[model samples]
Target: MNLHLLLADDDIDDCDFFKEAIDEIGQLTLSILNDGVELMNFLLAEPANRPNLIFLDLNMPKKSGMECMEEIKSINKLKDIPIIIYSTSLDRTVVNHLYEMGAHHYIQKPGEFSNIKKVVEKAISLFTSTNSQLRSKEQFIIYP
Candidate 1:
């Protein structure tokens, strides 16, 4: 099945790497937004094009990922869309907070291209599986 994935990140290189990894995986469509404001606008404006999954960066311009998460979750129509926290930081406090705030998963940005591909593929597979269920905090992070 084809999965529509949306990424909200400020770093161009990270965005490029993510796109490349998704391309390698195939059968996925990706749309990227550079900042939290743009991400929220896109999501709010196009209800018909809501993605199956969203990858959000913690630190972003205009608004932070935490703020975006709060807004998204507050909206009834957008609340069910799965959101994955994709970031370079691995702070336990932040990760825990995100999980509490309803992020579906957390992925630490991998240093290697192959690792990036592996994590992305794993996330997609887990989300698309027939028996897939929202994981508990103990099982939230997806490691490469």
Candidate 2:
């Protein structure tokens, strides 16, 4: 199965770095969205091909990540897709709030390329593993 990733960040450098890191870390097809508006549009336009993981930056033009999270969770169809907040902020309250608001994971943007790769790998693994377990249980239940 192909793992599709949606990157929602306004920082050009960070976006480029993330793409390189993801390429080095694993095999992933990523869709780039510079802001939350585009992110939502992409999701809304292609519901069938919804990204498996979303890397969202808290700060961006057009719309913020927090606002996007609220919108995403309110929409039933988009709620299940795992959202990973990838930002530079170290605010505990913001992190906690995002978690409460249905963000699947929160990751502080790494300063180094290597760290970025490590974090990406971890995120991808967690996403795939959890989904795999869910699928396994689902299959057993349906077949048994």
Whose TM-score is greatest here?
A: 1
lDDT of 1 by residue, 16-121 (tens): 9999999988889999999999999999997788999999999999999999999999999899999999999999999999998989899999999999999998
- CA displacement after TM-score superposition, residue 124 of candidate 2 (Å): 0.6
Please tell me which predicted candidate would have the highest lDDT against the true structure. Answer: 1
Number of clashing residue pairs in every model?
Answer: 0, 0
lDDT tens digits, residue span 1-144, model 2 = 579999999999999999998787667898888998998899999777799889999998899999999999899898878788889886878877776777777778888888888888877777777663232211211100
Predictions in order: lDDT:
0.91, 0.80
The 10 consecutive residues of candidate 2 with the worst lDDT sum are 135-144
Candidate 1 lDDT (Cα, whole model)?
Answer: 0.91
lDDT, residue 5, model 1: 98
TM-score, cand. 1 vs. native: 0.96
Off by over 4 Å in 2: 131-144
Estimated TM-score for each candidate: 0.96, 0.88
